[model samples]
Target: MDKSAMSDPQQPATVAILAYPEATASVVYGMYDLFMATGRDWGIVTSGEAGPSLLRPLVVAARAGPLLATNEVRIEAQASLQECSSADFVCVPDLNIPPGESLEGRFAEEVEWLRRCYAAGATLASACSGTLLLAEAGLLDGQEATVHWAYCDELRRRYPKVMVRAQRALVVSGEGQRLVMAGGGTSWLDLALFLIARSVGVDAAMQVARINLIDWHAIGQQPFARLARTRQVEDAIIAGCQTWIAEHYCEHSPVAAMVRLSGLAERSFKRRFQLATGMSPLDYVHRVRLEEAKQMLESGDDPIEAIANAVGYEDAGFFSRLFRRSVNLTPAQYRRRFGSMRRALNAGV
Candidate 1:
């Protein structure tokens, strides 16, 4: 799959989408539809005539047969790993594997095939947890990548050589910039559009997006991330403090209050707190306060200053800056993005 051939208008780019039992059917079929529509749908929508097909998408699995995918959806593979030797693009859709589970002993054949495809000059793209396959195949080593926010920690833990950009919606890295990865949820739409724009043209990609009414996730994943609750630790003292702080996070000098409640020397308590929670006492407090602020922003109509004060920050400017750094959005922007949805749900209720 030469780059020139992919860019040529006369030849359609072949995209092989890898599928397995754990794969999500929606992402696999959604990308197939988008790629298949690239150059063909625009003409039909505008001029009442179908245009030339710019991309040929085929679902490639370990064996050519029907397999049940996540949520009990049946997916038919058009080709097997041995049959599909090479293509202009290789796409791995989201897999329904748990973030903390080991990927060892899984997708052995598919991983080997991906390595061969990359060696043959095929561009590799993954959506969401599908990036795990590329990482497991060692294609993402020493390259920047991103996955769904929940999987970011596990990706970094397993592949220390890969730089994890958890806040980005999309990342393009690796040799010749051929590896493309999308972040959580529907960001695969971004990945598909990027590949289309790169291979065919930006105009074709834009036309497809318009036809599908796909909204680009430009703000990235930070705004959508919820702070994961700290798991219960073996240290009873620290665990009790955690429970106390969750309710008293908006109080003055919450860390010092926790130290007083722990009944340990201040320095010893801070050391033990970090060891147990994997975060400094002050950082933990900020996380709790920010989590509360996010809830207020989503569920209420409070002003920024009022929300900041309620979240234990008297200085509204400092709160605003900290919120922007942590959540990648100001209070108003967070409200605008999530408040409407909250209101809509409330209205439905």
Candidate 2:
């Protein structure tokens, strides 16, 4: 387990992919296929001969046997925690558990195995909710990490010491940059490529990507995130205001109109709204407007200025700046990215 030996190109790095009942089958198998392809598949496709395998990927579970994963997919584990004592890298695939669900007694053995791997100089990596396991293991304390966007808030709430970057598609942190994570969805492809590049070589990783037609998620997760909806609150007045604002967000002085509709003094209305929704009335209005703008940009080919006006912003420059600040992408950029997706789907239909 010499760290220095890991740099040798001739040495195939051992990758232990953790599998459990909560694991997603696609992520587990996808990562396994990609890692197995790293140094060997490219040459086979090009010259009809396999090249040297650079990584050894093993599906490791608590018990070495067939297990049912999320969605009832059967996964055959190559080794158990007790059998796989150490590895050069440990990968935790996306878990199907809800973000807010308690992990109080879950993955106890897997977490302990991860801690042992880290202590043995193995790099730890996760995809999506799998970052929760790393956090639960106390491996990500005070370290910056990224998870599936929906889980980012929950991760922050559960582990205040861990810095969560919801916008990043991939993040590398921890001592010697040993911890790596990929954001939600299929960004696990990026995680696999990154580890291959780091362990084998960049050329090997690029070849694997080309062979698999895998593209890196360079745009990050901001554009894909659905704006958090304002949940209905116990306060009837604020709840009524929320329903009203959803329809009339494009109207000028909407917050003022809401205040009047609330039938309370403006000062009292604002205070009650904040207490109910956790944001000021004006901020809530902006969220509604931006969410509408996002939908229009994704579904239509309207000009940016026109979309801005439709969303209640007359000054296109101001709208663009605000959109960039809030969504991390300008209206035009968001359209270009998501609009094409819409069209592609429509064309197929």
Candidate 3:
């Protein structure tokens, strides 16, 4: 339970990005840009709701002194590290705190401030190596957390009392209290946007997404699929081909054309394609067509032949057979089942 991850309910969700005497500029700028880009008070000004909040953010340095910046960017700090009041969320952001120098002496000051803030009802959060700050603070002594996978082993080794889990994007603990953490450098944006969404609303979160050009689905979502690491290059090729196929399904692009895009020789491409996706290129194309046919069947009233041809299938029976084989149901049956599910989900909501 990294103390930084635990958010306080009473705080207007102020994130005071901690500026260590030797913190990196990238982390500092990243935190600053991410927050300002994503956060804005709508000033609904309703009598019932709290009037437009003045709770913005401040980047402060430890020890109430000037701090060295990374990459020669000397940003001024307006608040002292000891100025821990007026914040519901305090972020160490990202910095490398040496293991031997942490959890004691000078590091004690930051930890004490963190504990005080948490006790005062502020959520404390860290990003990447910033988790080390919390571990040093002893808040993670018996709690599960996630750091960048490269640092997970070292964090666990240095603080044996902290239970480290590496499989997820973000780790959360503390019910009334909160301890949430993330792996990967860019995941900091995810954590920040998530905090914004929780404190504000989805509109603010989406603004963050547009600012960072981030994928909307992954923000605030946990247990991110590790599949990206396993087959990133291959997946990119496949996704490119998939997009091409979807756009050109009606054009009836040849399998050889798709195989060429994979950059592998025909025979080798077929083998790898089947190994990667469990289906040959043409079979996958056919599957896509059949899937589209199923979709058409639900919202559309076109004839089966027209739908089949629209998805690159000319023979009606062949399309039906392929659709049934891949989807475990006939096109009509799939339309019924999935359409029912979609309608039910929408209606229930």
Model 3, 31-50: lDDT tens per residue? Answer: 67666654442322223333
Worst 10 residues of 2 by lDDT: 1-10
Query: What is candidate 1's CA lDDT for residue 185?
Result: 79
Candidate 2 residue lDDT tens string, 1-349: 3455456666789899999999989999999999888878998999999987889899999999999999999999999999888888999999888766899977889999999999988999999889999999999999999998888877888999999998899999998999999997899999999999998889999999999899899988877776554455689999999998888999999999998999999999999998776579998888789889999998888899999999899999999998898778888888888899998999998
TM-score of each: 0.92, 0.91, 0.53
Candidate order, lDDT descending: 1, 2, 3
Candidate 1 C-alpha lDDT tens digits along 88-169: 9999999798777888978899999999999988999999999999999999999999999878877888999999999999
- Winner on TM-score between 2 and 3 is 2
- Lowest summed lDDT over 10 consecutive residues: which window, candidate 1? 1-10
Candidate 2: residue 321 Cα off by (Å):
1.0
For residue 133, model 2's alpha carbon misses the true position, in angstroms, by 1.3
Best by TM-score: 1
